[model samples]
Target: MTAAQFKSNRFDLAVDTISRADLEEVIAWLRKYPRLTMGEESKRFEQAWSKWLGVKYSVMCNSGASANLLMYAALESAGRAGKRKVVVPATGWVTDIAPAIQFGWQPIMCESDPVTFGLNMDSLAKILKRDHPENVVLVHVLGVPVNMTRLLALQKQYGFNIIEDCCASHGSRHQGRLVGTFGLISVFSFYYGHHMSTVEGGMLCTNDEHIYHHLLMLRSHGWLKDLPAADARRIMKKYRVDPFHAPFTFTIPGFNLRPTEISARTGSIQLRKLDATIRRRVANHLIYQKRLNGAVDFARGIPGDVISSISFCAVAKSAAQRRKIIETLDKKRIDTRIFTAGNLGRHPFWADRFGVFSAPVADKLYRGGFFLPNNQSLQGTDIEYICGVVRKALE
Candidate 1:
């Protein structure tokens, strides 16, 4: 049975992740000082994020797309390990593929697992065996954690760099470790609809000291001033700059993608409630698993992985069937969407340039998969009713 409150309302795919109290807290702080640019609050948020993600450093930026760009730029600037080819999943956002091409790196797209919606290791292993790409960008699509233990083993055998894109995944884990900590560089998005929200912000995380410094420069305008004290001195000695000019030194090509004090303050407040948010999202997702497991093609978390469940994804048996299901959901006042940009390989941006390589699994998802509303604000009845609509549509 539908809840009385929800009977007359259209269920939305996302809600404002920011709480009213958190918004008030930021307003009160802003009124007191009026300084909203990147500052101590940004630093505080970065440190806290690092601690939570089990990484050494986290640099805040304007958006997750910028975080992706900064990561590729940093790797390119540092001179990648004699390997120019980067492998990315075909089922990721455009930013994931665009940055690699923009930075002059050759990116080969791989198929995604129908269940996890991450790079299929078998498919990736085949590409690694044939082409031997040095870098792999792994997106934990829709908050489902990839099996890192197996992926890391393949990394050891293949000797490649891993860039974990955890933009849709916060508080997600593979085994016991967090998703963002298992790679050379990790990225997160704190946009309005994600696990947490800073309104419009992202973070770049790394454990390596040099890469950390590189990210700092990339986030700002490639100035030595952004470097830590010792690192700044090292740069000064390397360049042999005048003491007065050292502070103004530009080390590498960079951009102005810094976050504001307002976003950082929001992030700080939102981070505290992330655990509770995940609990609600996961609980709602379990209803989908219990009710619609064999009836529809839904995203499934790998064994021993804790999913953040940003949304519930359903793949209809055919493209025509998907359209009918969406129509049914619409009539039921349920909202639905395509699965995360729907296979970047099939899109015009990639098709016009490289020509589309057949990624059967990703292509199938592109044609048939649609997203169901799953968020912190959804309750038991909402989840059940949404899934019920799907079951009836199939009937």
Candidate 2:
């Protein structure tokens, strides 16, 4: 490809999904001089997110990484983190497993699935059988729904709690059910490039009331101020605390991972357009899949699942081929990156402490995976053009 051709078409790996109109909405809200901290707006966003996600409760936090931390904290606070041994995926982001290490939990890494690039069921089964972990954390890698059918069956058989990281998998579904709804607690990111943007925000969702209460306390300074009135009163009475001091009472150790009213306001605005954004991304992803079929290998996902991908991840035949394709994409002015962490196990964070995790699929992804643009801004033709660039590079 010529440099002139590169200047003609530019494709970004991530285009901010938050529109000018959405910013206008935030500006309007700001002009009202509303409360800008975690208040009514945050509550509204949480409720809206819960309703949309088909979950009973949702807690908004500063970032998805914090949400992951809170998930581990809540699990321990609620006495649900048995043995503190968790099964984490080798293909997911580091934060998915970092919290385990931070909490001094024993994290057993599982291999990536060949089809969905999620946790390999056979590998997870092996972990469950041998390790008997208390929890299993899985990411719907790049918006492709994991094999939830097999995963759920394994959960039933192994009796392990499930925590899902749906940060990049918004609107993805497995067997007509949403990805986040299946886990004991699921986390979502509303970062700038995701399906929606709250500037820097995330949500922790769950149907368990006890866990929900624990999340409220864990989100703040482990205080009862954010808890429901009845629950707070019950806690106060149990501890023989006075009403004056109950609100400030620290229940369990927590952090100030609170979202600002501005983020919450933006989230409310972005939430309105989330479904539309998801539809566009999903459509664009399918176009990439169909066009790049045999030219490069990628996740096919399950037959009935929906993929609302943040980026289309493709695996070249070899590391050399991947380098060539990335070079071509760069020359074409198309933004691309190595697949999300490729293998967290190979990263220094994990490798320094534990030896390199070697598995066929994970190692292959580590060497060959690359991300292509897939955002709400791209259309079918854009995807086709990108695929053509990749196919030509392969040739």
Candidate 3:
């Protein structure tokens, strides 16, 4: 914890996943075609992402938050706003919940499962029984896939639309299939600290063609130009507009959330390395689990679920122990963080409007959850050292 410790190279929670070669690849693309914007490169990246995730369509956007916004907006546009309520997990980034509320949808906060750090079925069942919400924003919290088998069954019974927030989960799988493919629409973040990097970008993936067409329009300025020629023509024919005016036509209200050619080009290069990056992350996570076994309390994927492990998490038995552990790790030159925005409902933004609802599991996470470094850069030795620090702190 001393100043000298700070000067040393610590096992930080995130190392830049984007390599120099990836940057050079982007530069090469730019140099080859200097006129860069969200065009061919963006389309190429979107196609690659769709193929990787096994989805019919993928739309690249400026950030994950924008992806969420467009997803919710697409739902609202599809006329689900009448139900007005959506179930959200207690543990996840604010953006996951914010866009829902911003779109005038009521957010029913559900408690987290200590095992998955996602919406616990018990709590979610209770919410579903009570509210019968038409939508559920499911976050694969920190790359640990939710109990999708159970959740999907519930979804079938309840008839709620599912939006999988895979913003932090690039390669995570549930039931042997990718996480994003399970829901109607899924999002992924390629920010600097995520599983991969586009410097700043995100993606929305879906199998639904209508949603896909809407997403294409929504990512841009809600114009017909981004849509498929047939789809755009249909809209034009319906509105009685000429081709000249079609370029300037605005359909649904939207924002320009498009990513640049640079981001997309960089993402295309980064995508090539994603599998290796995920393998290293899994390796480090296993090391953390083996080393920190019995000392920490956090979720791990079951047999059919695979975690990308953006950062390995450890939950202390008590709030005091959690604080001590964080301070101790800092002294040892290790980086730690609260698990992904811990209990979005506990934050002032939601609490002020909703009047402080209680979610025991999320509250437990808010008080005790902390993350350890787990990324492509971390070696087995580094993971061992970090775990040793954690063990000492717990002691």
Candidate 4:
């Protein structure tokens, strides 16, 4: 397509990473009348995912939210979820914190950092001193890598397990390390319009062997069927159960969050093109940052870190300015939306439980943060044009 023709089309906040060719592959596989349930395809996708993310194990689930739920459940099942006091981010999707609340953990809301838009280290340190929480969940907000250098130092001192919500940050890196690799258990989403699409799916990844075993059982029905044969045999010996009844044996209380073979097959196909997608997104994001610099505020992230942003998030000077910019974007046929959840604390789900989470950076993001298109579909020219529209709106 010509550049002008492409620009004439709607500039979306996200675009499906899956192409017609990918769908054709899926269709061809469907003709085989293969097992649609979680089977070999799911295993292959998980293995491919683990290798890509540099993790030892990966568990595919129904959705990213399901992966978050599995992370909490895995912690508890492994007997490592101490105190049930988990620190959650103020500027992330609700799922980042909701699982903590649903799992009956005391959720302490942390402020957003001015630069990275992830957890504010100062706020987290204060919480560590005060609440003494055992776990902290953070999102690489909008694919901007959190300041893991500081967060990891805090983890060492305070000794809290890190649960990274990388659902929107598939290829983000901090200090040359992948975001998901830093956490005890990290989650990624493969829903439509994300880094990639499996139609609907998520992945839970970890390096710890014990946590890996628990994730395998918890992803299904807490049965030994999915567990490694060696692990299953050991468990059976411990319970004095015979091999005949082992597969049906229940271990920990689990949920049915299995991904279908179709989704898994789609995921494997999408994974192949993910690196190219990341490259295009990274280039587009740089264009946004360069052209819009000083004209608007956005997460700068830590220096030297790679940001594989899903969308180019910018904060207008005020709420009125944001409305004006968004209006301009809409008029120009560009898609835009308020930042992810604004502040999760402002939502009724959180407000009803613990009063509005008030903080300088987070409240500002709630009032002024907005998203701009930064998917793999957009080119440098498209981003520059979008930036021009935004800058004109600000004037």
What TM-score would each prediction reach against the true structure? 0.97, 0.98, 0.96, 0.98
How many residue pairs clash (N, CA or C atoms closer than 3 angstroms) in each of the candidate models, in the order given?
Answer: 0, 0, 1, 0
Better of 3 and 4 by lDDT: 4
TM-score, prediction 1: 0.97
Order by lDDT, highest first: 2, 4, 1, 3
Q: Better model by lDDT, 2 or 3?
A: 2
TM-score, ranked from best to worst = 4, 2, 1, 3
Model 4 poorest ten-residue lDDT run: 1-10
lDDT of 4 at 329: 90
Candidate 2 versus the native: TM-score?
0.98
lDDT of 3 by residue, 208-252 (tens): 888888888877788989988988999999999999999889998
Q: What is the per-residue lDDT of model 2 for residues 293-374, given as tens digits with 9 covering 90 to 100?
A: 9899999999989999999999988999999999999987898899999988999999999999899999899999999989
Q: What is the C-alpha lDDT profile of model 1 across 311-341, one tens digit per residue?
A: 8877888999999999999997787899887
Candidate 4, residue 216: how far the Cα is off, in Å: 0.9
lDDT of 4: 0.91
Better of 1 and 4 by lDDT: 4
RMSD of each: 1.5, 2.1, 2.5, 1.3
The parts of candidate 4 lying over 4 Å away from their true place are 1-8
For all candidates in order, the CA lDDT equals: 0.87, 0.92, 0.85, 0.91
**Which ranges in model 3 have alpha carbons more than 4 Å from their true place?**
1-8, 80-82
